[model samples]
Target: MLKQFCEHCGEETEHKEVIKQKPSKYGKSKKEQFKAFLSGFFGGVASQVGASLDLIDRYVVCKKCGRKKLENLGDEFQ
Candidate 1:
C-alpha cells in the first residue's frame, strides 16, 4: 500500500495495496519466505532509523483521497 502522512489530520495512513511481484519458482520456498519477511522487517527498521536521523523527507497526504496535501489542510503538496 502507498503509505502517506496526513498533515491535515496529523495521522499516518495508506491508500492502495502496492502491487509487488511474487517470487519466482526458484524463490518460492519456506526459507525464501522467511528471508523475504526478514528483509522487509530490516528494511522497515532501517527506514525508520533513517527518518529519525533526518536523512529523508516527510510526505503528507490526504487521508480519504490519498492525495499529496499538507500545505493548508486543503491544498496538495505537489
Candidate 2:
C-alpha cells in the first residue's frame, strides 16, 4: 500500500501499484518461450538489460474511487 493524493478522491488515500499491459508489442521481441534444461545449466535469460523498454505501464490506483494516475518515476532515475 502507498499513500498518495488522488485527484478523484480529493484527498490523500491509499494507492496500489498497478502495471498494465503495454500498448503494443510491434518491433519488440516477444516474451521468449520458457525453456528448461536438466543437464547442468538452467534456462537462458531473454534480456541482458533486464526488463523491456516501455513494455508496460505503471500507475497508482486509488483504493477508494478506483481512479488511476500515471506514475512517472522513470524520469527521475534517467
The lDDT of each candidate is 0.47, 0.59
- For all predicted structures, in order, the TM-scores are 0.29, 0.59
Root-mean-square deviation (CA) per prediction? 10.7, 7.0
- In candidate 2, what are the lDDT values of residues 1-78, reduced to their tens digit? 699999888999999998654445333334321111211023113211223324446799999999999874454443
Q: Of the candidates shown, which would achieve the greatest lDDT relative to the real structure?
A: 2
Predicted structure with the largest TM-score when compared to the true one: 2
**Predicted structure 2, TM vs. truth:** 0.59
* Pairs of colliding residues, candidate 2: none
Output the worst ten-in-a-row residue range by lDDT, candidate 1.
Answer: 69-78
Q: In model 1, where do residues sit more than 4 Å from their true spots?
A: 1-26, 47-78
- In the range 1-78, model 1's lDDT, one tens digit per residue, is 666665555667664432232343336788987776666556666544442222223444454766664222212322
